[model samples]
Target chain A: MSLLSNSAVEKNMDLAPAPLKKEKVKMKKGLQLFLIALPFLILVFVFSYLPLYGWSYAFFNFRPGIPLSQSEFVGFQWFKSIISNPTQTAEVMRVMKNTLAISALGVITSVLPVTFAIFLTEIKASWYKRIVQVLTTLPNFISWVLVYSVAFAIFSTNNGLLNHVLTDLGIIDTGVNYLASDNHTWLSMCMWNVWKTLGWSAIMYLAAITNIDPELYEAAKVDGAGRFRRIWHITVPGLMSTYFVLLLLQIANFINNGMEQYYVFQNAINKDHIEVLDLYVYNIGMLGTNFSFATAISMLKSIVSVFLLFFANKMSKILRGESII
Target chain B: MAESILIKKKTKKEKENSRSTKGEIVFNFFNMAFFALITFICIFPFYYLFVNTISNNDLSSRGMVIFLPKGIHFTNYLQVLRLEGLGRAAIISLSRTLIGTILTVFGCALLGFIFTQKQMWGRKFWYRFVVITMYFNAGIIPWFIIMMNLKLTNNFLAYILPAVIQPFFVILVKTYIESIPAAIQESAELDGAGTMTVFFKIIMPLSKPILATITVFAAVNQWNSFIDTLFLMTDSKLYTLQFVLYRYMNQLSSLANIIRGSQGGSSISASIANMQTPTSVRMTVSMIIITPIILVYPIFQRFFVKGIIMGAVKG
Candidate 1:
């Protein structure tokens, strides 16, 4: 036992010098990394984390140019106000409905086109596939403002392309006011959203499809399966994982219909169908200068989005044995 | 062995039932129709925009041209170029996108490298900190407040600074960095190279594909962005291309007034006269705004696909 202890001491003494050197090197590396990360840490704290404290402003009647501590805090006052006010409450619900409807339409229209594009890329004609891919994706780069303008050109009552073509062909006696009609507004918004997004969304699925093994297709061919049969059996099953992942991620943003596209397209004529939650927040916060109420709504949105994300992640695990979060 | 025998029997039965003539015909017919329909819907808008841009203003005004050009006219393009704010707005937008993208990519890359180092203390804490920011933000109002407090409201810094270090870009860069092999770092350390030296010399070079992808993504995002300008920029002089185009879209009728005035027509009363809305002009403006970005897209598309696929698979 004494002999073993003497050898252990000798070994410890021999190894101590190298470990000390390693510790010094690690400390140096840590210091350098901290220095490098200092600015980012400061930025995250100031911009992201600090404003989280401002969630407290939802309880207060927040005003600019006043210290937050000095502001009067009335617990749940904004939430109570939102609930008690019938007109405001109706507007909120209306906007929420509009947001969901638009997003649902967008998701439905986008999914098939995206899936088709991914499948189409697997076709034999390489050049044709490339052209189709390029042409399809070109629109994704175009801004919503541009898309709205194109829609305006086509659907304008006075001089729109559709009105002109219909009138020229003697199909209609009068021009159609497509933009002003509330019934058509939501559909128009959905069409525009799908047009801008379908190709971009397809890119993700296309990447997923490319990752699929080519040997599966050969095996299906050897079984004397036709193209459509093979696509149904093989291509779709291959894309299932990616489809689920993207679908879950997208569902997490169910409440966040884009603000800019809606805001730009929205007119008083189409306000009923187009005033989504993001725009509602923008109008109330930026335009109306109702800072506290807007903050309260924003806080509510954050909570809801977080819950949705968690729920979606959990559901993904339940359904697919994988979750993004 | 029993399951394999059953599977083989099932395959033989399926093969005997497959390859029906009616099924092939029906499949071909529907496939062709669906393909044509999808392609038409996707491609028609670009054709519409192109035809409208080149068609004579009068033909467009009369709503004569729909699918094809009545007469090719470059006059609108010339007129757009001659517009007062066009050149300046283009320049402002171009410079802002270029500068903004460069700063954002480098900053995110540097931060990503630092965060990925295993020796860094509290690395997990910082990673969580950044990721949490991705999920929750104080909304645009508080961000605007921060910008105001920093006195960045109207200056170009307002546009650039707020967007310089996006949480998404940082995450993407970190993911890309993590995929790089650790052996390179070990060699650099043996050479007595510091973290910065290793990052700039070894790590960044290996990350060219991702860096290029980030550049394109950031550039396109910055170029297409108008909301930032809407909130931060009060000055018309500082307007980006998209914002300027939006202004024209909102005030489209004013272009007709300018054109009519140039044509020596009777001065139309501002309130009563129904001015031509320049529907084609709006289309032309849209094209003008997006043309630069579209022209540059193919260069980035290659990097974008590779980088995203690699990142997604690795993640």
Candidate 2:
């Protein structure tokens, strides 16, 4: 890392000064660059690092409208409470269960997007391919709230189209409350997630496919290889590096299941199955205005996530000979 | 890179020259069928939403309008368009997207240009300063407290400020600017142009494709973001369109559940019918929310695709 940063510094500047004035000119350039970079630097410090400083609230009995300096400093109390109290432990466990279930489903289905991209590339008709690509990618740009609306429209008990079609075909006597049911929470979330992000994620793989060395395909063709053979031997291997990079990043983010989609999809009946680690923090923090306690758990999650990220970065470096960080 | 692409095109044309064997024909048939199924699955929900939103109210309520529209009615959209606070919510959403995208794209472009300039002292430190934020944060509760402490709550600046410092985007913009020949900027500098002048007068014009790409990303992010509004905005006057939709959906569903619990059976449908937002209008709300994106996505898609590939592969 030190070597890379040093080389970066050397490569960035075009000017090479004589030894007599090297330090003076370098200092002048550094000052100029620092001025140019200052505004964004301060913005990032306030937004990113300041919140990290706020994590100190984990050690206090923080209350709103009361300054942290005035609050009682109780080191390890909130962290212990996450495990010592039965209710807190159960809540934390339940949140962890949902988080793991959803993430596992997400990781399992990651292959679908890659497969989708491969199949998409094989389409002979250009117009149909374009239409499909555009339509599929549209949902990715919409909010989770809008996606929930579509989900409810298709899966709502009394008026959902899925239930309507099923009933009309004599599949059932009445509508199935799939949206309200907690039995398939993991399955439903995975399906919705795939439906929403498949096209957007597939674009990465498609771009990778477009970047494959064409000589390999041409040579394979000359060797009497079929399309499937070319795809399996060449295209798939070309995509593996990209796939593994993304997959490692995903693993690093295993505990960071974002709250928005699950937040919108949540109902009273399904809340038990829907709430993940981040949502639980939001819920508990807002539930009784227990800021410090919630921050403690949030702090723990953030630490674990960072540790996982570094571990994953190391693994990728060792295994793939490439490091993301 | 251009030559490689040209080679790929020629090779593809060469491959198309040969007659397809029977096995290849079968494979193509299956491939088409698979993709057709996948495409239908992707597009069906929006089609269903649009048809049902335009269908007759009673049939839709009874879950009968499955395949197509029973009656084409524009009333739902008209009513939704006229809903109270909707115009205000839309103004909030629009202004935020516009202002946020402009600031973010500009900041990123400027910082991106700066990062690539070796003459800038400590450029690596400044570049990594923001990218680290992309992977690490204090998580939700502490971040919320920080936002609260900063007094960004219920403030318009809350919506517009944070986006301007997006590190990933700055990195993306920097990668793109780096692709432009160094001589262009070097020559400008030699001509006595300052860094600011070179960035605004030269780099900005040449980086239009990438700027457009990041603009779309920032705009979409700003437009679709609701979690910020949900957490930060206590004042209804500050609500964005998506936040309003969320509250409305929760309200309707909870109200429907209460009426169903009390009245039961067919009367449940009656109470739901009496609700402020009907099924058709709810679907219309979904359509309203996504229509702008759907309308302009194709025009901006090439840039989006270009940006993603450029950033992802290079990163």
Candidate 3:
């Protein structure tokens, strides 16, 4: 009876979906998936992969309506010319400095406000939290153009609100032309950046904080830890991973000091402080019609940013023992 | 459960205990005051904008408008609407945003469905392809060139086509889809349902939460997009709301020039004394531009909150 039972079990196992049937199923599934994916692959290749070929134009004298064969392929010529021209080089460097300064300030101001917002959410007042949430997010939906116009109205030299208030309060003898001064432009831009982004950035941190295990907070309280201590120990540490990831992402975009705000804000007076790489590209490529030089400059920015992103990723992995990439 | 009762009793005890601690009382007072102050500053700008929008144009020009409007003048709003190109531009912007949102949400959903299937061949390669595009784009020049070559310039398609299938949204949707249990899919497959039916009938219904999220995101992005219109839409009729606002501001500056010139030799400065095209007009214009979005936001605010949280937490 035992021998018969063993033989029957062996036979059942052999009859159960043979290896060849399994292989066929796997192959069919693979083919079905490929068929579904083929359309997106083609779309991406045409739109995304094809444009990569034009990156070579940075080294050439690129012209509209000229075939690749007809266009002059002067290797590294435009790059060398841009570096050699003192005016062009100075403009690039100045914009780079401004971009860094504004972006750094944006990052600093944004982090503090968002952190403060997350802390405020812990307070017992639901109405206060609700109102703060609404106000912070309201500015984000407003267009940058409108924000600039508002700034213009409020900061105009002769009849601005700030000036009127200051003069009325006897804080100043004359109304200062806040927008006209180069020193104030960068600061104003930083404030605008913070205004636009603070609430939105805080949302992510707040979400992350909510996900923290309640047990940790309870344990901290049981150990006689106050609100600040609990926040410093439990909340901040719980948020460290998210903070690092977001920080790395922000650092990766360090060169992209906003284009629209700077473009709209640019005037004869505040041009020095407001000009950034994006505005520089728009001026040279689109406005000036020097496509080749602009491409070269953009290529340089891209290369540097890619390197920085990779380096930051590596450093993050080392520090957190986790890879965001 | 025990902890809750203990915490309640402890809170009562702590309230009695804190009656003796002046330092604690002072600290709590300052904490509450500080938060209240921060909240006020955060909210004051929007209040200022709203008051400026409704206040008298002359009063706004004189910088006398402060916390509240002296008189409500809807005339500035009427003026903005009557501006030469405002109405047409608003319609164009609305239609484009609507169409773009629909197309983007659909395309992203389809792409996400394809990506989430584990049985797909070269899935890794395809996923990486999408992610690479998300990270690196050829910037604006090449994109503009492609649109021109495609004969998309001056067409509404120029605004909608390039943005219709963003890879990041696809990846987000795909991740959400991946979180769905595979067992459910297996049962549907065993019931002899085709891939399309399974996707449409099963996956989509289950993915409504994420679908709601991406829809709001796509809508907001399309509403805010102005650069594409500026670059691609050379025709005045094709201008979006943002582009229209931009032109209005430019026109204001030019009008300021003309008014100043026409009032030549006047003791009263033309730019200052005109009072017709004051800061209030700009504020009114802004309010008009954002009115639709603000009204629509609350409707989708819940979905937006959930979606944003999901994407951030998962990523």
Off by over 4 Å in 1: A1-17, A62-73, A118-122, A221-226, B1-33, B67-71, B253-277
Task: Give each candidate's fraction of reference contacts reproduced.
Answer: 0.41, 0.71, 0.34
Taking all chains together, the TM-score of candidate 2 against the true structure is 0.88
Listed in order, each prediction's TM-score against the native is 0.86, 0.88, 0.86
Q: Pick the candidate with the highest DockQ.
A: 2
Best by lDDT: 2
- Candidate 3 residue spans exceeding 4 A from truth: A1-39, A63-69, A170-175, B1-16, B19-25, B253-280
B1-315 in candidate 1: lDDT tens per residue?
Answer: 999999999998777657465676676566556656766777786677778778766766787667778867666666565556767888888898889998889888988887888889888888788777776677666666667666777888776766677777787888888888666676566557878789889988999877888888888888888788888888878887788778776775776665455435334332221223366557777778767766887666667666666555633
Candidate 3's clash total is 0
Predictions in order: chain A TM-score: 0.87, 0.88, 0.83
Of models 1 and 2, which has the larger lDDT? 2
Instruction: Please tell me how candidate 3 rates in CAPRI terms.
Output: acceptable
User: What is candidate 3's lDDT per residue for B1-315, written digit by digit as tens?
Assistant: 999999999999788568646665676567667767766765566667777777776777677888888677665565556555667888887887899899888878877887888778878888888777766666666656666667888998777767777787887789888888765666566557777788889888999988888888888888878777767888988988788767656676864553344345544332333344635555666777777777887677667667767666655
Q: What is the lDDT, from 0 to 100, of the residue B301 in candidate 3?
A: 67
Model 2 spans > 4 angstroms off? A1-30, B1-20, B253-277
The global C-alpha lDDT for each of the candidates, from Candidate 1 onward, is 0.75, 0.83, 0.74
Model 1 C-alpha lDDT per residue in residues A233-294, reported as the tens digit of each score: 88788888877777787788888876888878878788888888888888888788787888
